[model samples]
Target: MAFSLGPRAASAGYRLAVFDRIGSTNAEALARARAGETGPIWLVAAEQTAGHGRRQRSWISPRGNLACSVLEVIDTSPAVAATLSFAAGLALEAALRTVSLEARMRSPGSENVTFHLKWPNDVLAGGGKLAGVLLEAETVAPDRLAVVVGTGANVAAAPEGMPYPAASLRDIGIDIGAEDLFGALTDAWAEFRIVWDKGRGFGEIRRLWLERAAGVGQHVSIRSDSSTISGLFDTIDKDGCLIVVTSDGRRVAVSAGDVYFGAAASVGAT
Candidate 1:
C-alpha cells in the first residue's frame, strides 16, 4: 500500500513521492532538489538497488523496510544543518514509543521493550539495531541550503548477517507495514522538528537525544579507516561528535567512526 500521511502533512503543503524501486531515496531527493523541485518533500521507495549508510557501507533495502528521504530548503549553515540527524533519531524514537505503547496495551507486562538512539543517527529497540538516519547536504544558494535526511527502518522484516544484529517491529511482535510506519514517522518528525527550528535548538535536541542514547557508558570500540579506539562511550559533544573515554582515562573526541559494543560490530552508527 502507498504511504498516506495525515492531515498535518497535507495542511502544511508537504510533498511526497513514492517509488517502487530506486537506487537511493537520499540520492533521489538530492537529484529532485537540484532539478528545481525544491520542497519540504519526501521520497519513499519500496526497495533499493544500491542503498548505503554512513561511511559508504551498504544498506540492505529489502522490501518492507522504510526506505525514505526528507528534503527541505533551509536557512541554516551546513554545520548546524547536520544536527538534523539527531532530530531524525529522536523522531524515530517517538514513533517506536507510540507503537510500542499500543503493543504493550495488548500484551501487558512486556519486558525489555524500549527504544534508544545510538550516537550520530541510529535507533535501537531493546538493544538491537532497528533504524538508521543519514544526512546529506548541498549549497542551494549563497544563503540557503537544501538537505536530505535519509532513513531506513525494518517494519515487517529484518536482514541477516549484518555487522550488528538487526531487528524489525515484526520480530518484536509489532506487525505493521512500511507505509504505516512511515505515516507515524512523518507525524513524529513534525513534532521533533519544532525543537530543531533550523538548527537554533541544537542544545535542546542534544539534551533530549542524550536521554535516549545507547552505550553512553558502555565498553566500546570505535573503528575508523585505519585504526580503532577502545573505550567507554561518553556523551556526544556540543558539536555532535562522539567523545570516548579510553581505558587509561584519556578522553578523545571522535568526529566520525563506527562504534561497537563489546564483540558485536555496530552498523548504521557513525
Candidate 2:
C-alpha cells in the first residue's frame, strides 16, 4: 500500500514524501532543510539501506520495516530542540498502541503486548527493543533550527544477537504493515507536536513520557563515551535528562548515554 498522511496530519498541513527505498529518511529530511525547505514534512522509506541511531550505531531497515522521519524548522535553541524527541517518543508509542491493538483484535486469544519508552530514544516491548527514535538538528539558517525526528521500527522482523534483546511486532503476534503503522504515526505525531508546542509544552510531554517509561525506578546503568554510571532509574527531569540515583544517594542527570536495566546493567557497564 502506498503511504499517505492520516487525516489529522493532512489537515495540519504536514507534507509527505514516500520512498520505496532510501539511504536514510533522517538524512533526506536534513538535506531538505539545508536547501531552505521550512516544513513540517514527513519523509518515509519502505527500506533504508544506510541508517544510524545515536552515536552512529547502525540501524538497517529492510523491507516491511518502518523507516520514517518528521522534519520541522523552528526558531529554537538546540537545547529546546532536543526535548522534541520526547514528544516523538510519545507519538510513536501512541501509534504503536493503536496499530498493535487493531492487529491483536483480529486474532482471537493473542497474547497481551505492552510498549514502553526507554530512556533517551528507544521503544521497548516485552522488555526488548521494538523500535528506536533519533533526533538530529542543525542550524540551517541563522535563527532557524532544522530538527528531524527519525524513527525505525521492526514491523516484520527484528535483528538477532544485539547488545540488548530485540523484538518485532510479528514476533509479538501482531501482524502489521509499515504503511499502516506510518499512517498511525503521522496522526499521533500531529497530536503530540501540538502538545510539544515547539518546546513550550515540554512539561506536559515530560510527564506523559514518564507515564509510559520503561525502566523508571529500576536498577540502571548508563554508559557514556567517557564513563559508565550505575544507579536507580529515578525520573526524567524537566529538561528531559535521565536522572539516576546512585547507590550513595546522589542524583545524577545524564544527558546522553546507553542505558541497561537489571542484571544487564553490569553487561552494559562493561
Candidate 3:
C-alpha cells in the first residue's frame, strides 16, 4: 500500500516510501542512511512483521496501525539529535488532535478524553498509552548526523496483553485511517520541525511539552534497572531530565527510566 503527503512535505523536499509490509521502518531507514541516503525522507509500513520499540521491546503492528520512520540530517551532537523525539511526539499529538477536535467539534466537552503527551515520547489517552516513539542516530560525517524518528501509533487497534493499558483512535471513537494519520503527521511534523529549528528552539518545545504533559503534578514512580523512585512528577528540566520531588522533599533529576503515573503500575514509555 502507498501513502500520500500534502503540500508541506512536498514543499520541504521530503521524500516518502510506503510499503505493505516491512520488518521495521527504522531499520530500513538506517540501512538507507548507511548507504549514504541521508535524507529528510519518511518510510511507512502498512504492516510490520518484526517491529520493535524503545529498549528493543516488540512493537506488534497489526494491519491498521500507523508505523513509520522519519530520516533527517542533523548538524548537531548526538545528544542534541536525540531530542528530535520530543518534536516527533509533539507532531504526533497535533495530528491526533486534528482528528479528535474534528470528531468532537459539536460536543467540545469531550476534549477531556483527548490524548496527551507524556514526557519524552508517549501519547496518552484515557489514562492509557496511544502511541510510542524510538530514536536512533548515526554520525555520517565529521559534523553531520542522520537521525531516524520511528513512531508506532494505535490507529485502528491497540495491542492486547500489553504490559501497560493501551488505547487506539478507533477504540476511543476517533475514526481515522493510517494513511490519513500519516498525512496529518507530515503536516504536523513540518510545523514542529520549524519550531524545533534543529534543537536551537528546544526551549519552546520544552514549554509546549510541559503544557501538554500528563500527570505533572501527580504522584509517580520511575523504575531503574535495580531500583525505583517515587515522587511528585514536578517537571522536565531544560535538558529534558525529569524533575521529581521525593517525599523527603529532595528534588531529583532523573535522566532515563520508565515512568508510571498514579497507582496504575502501568509503564508508558517514550
TM-score (all chains, Cα) for each model: 0.91, 0.98, 0.93
Q: At residue 134, what lDDT does model 3 achieve?
A: 89
RMSD of each: 2.8, 1.0, 2.7
Ranking of predictions according to TM-score: 2, 3, 1
Deviating ranges (above 4 Å) for candidate 2: none
Query: Model 1, 140-222: lDDT tens per residue?
Result: 88878889999999887788888677888888877667887787788888777778888878899999999998888888777
Which candidate's TM-score is highest? 2
Model 1 spans > 4 angstroms off:
105-112, 263-270
Give lDDT tens digits, candidate 3, residues 112-190.
4667888767999965799998899888889898899999999999999987889998887777688888888988998
lDDT tens digits, residues 1-270, model 2? 899999999999999998988999999999999898889999999889999999999999999999999999999999999999999999999999999888868877887788999989899996689999999999987878999999999999998878778999998888989999999999999999999997999999999999999888999999999799999999999889999999999999899999988998999989
Instruction: State candidate 2's TM-score.
Output: 0.98
The stretch of ten residues in a row with the least summed lDDT in candidate 2 is: 103-112
Using lDDT as the measure, name the better of candidate 2 and candidate 3.
Answer: 2
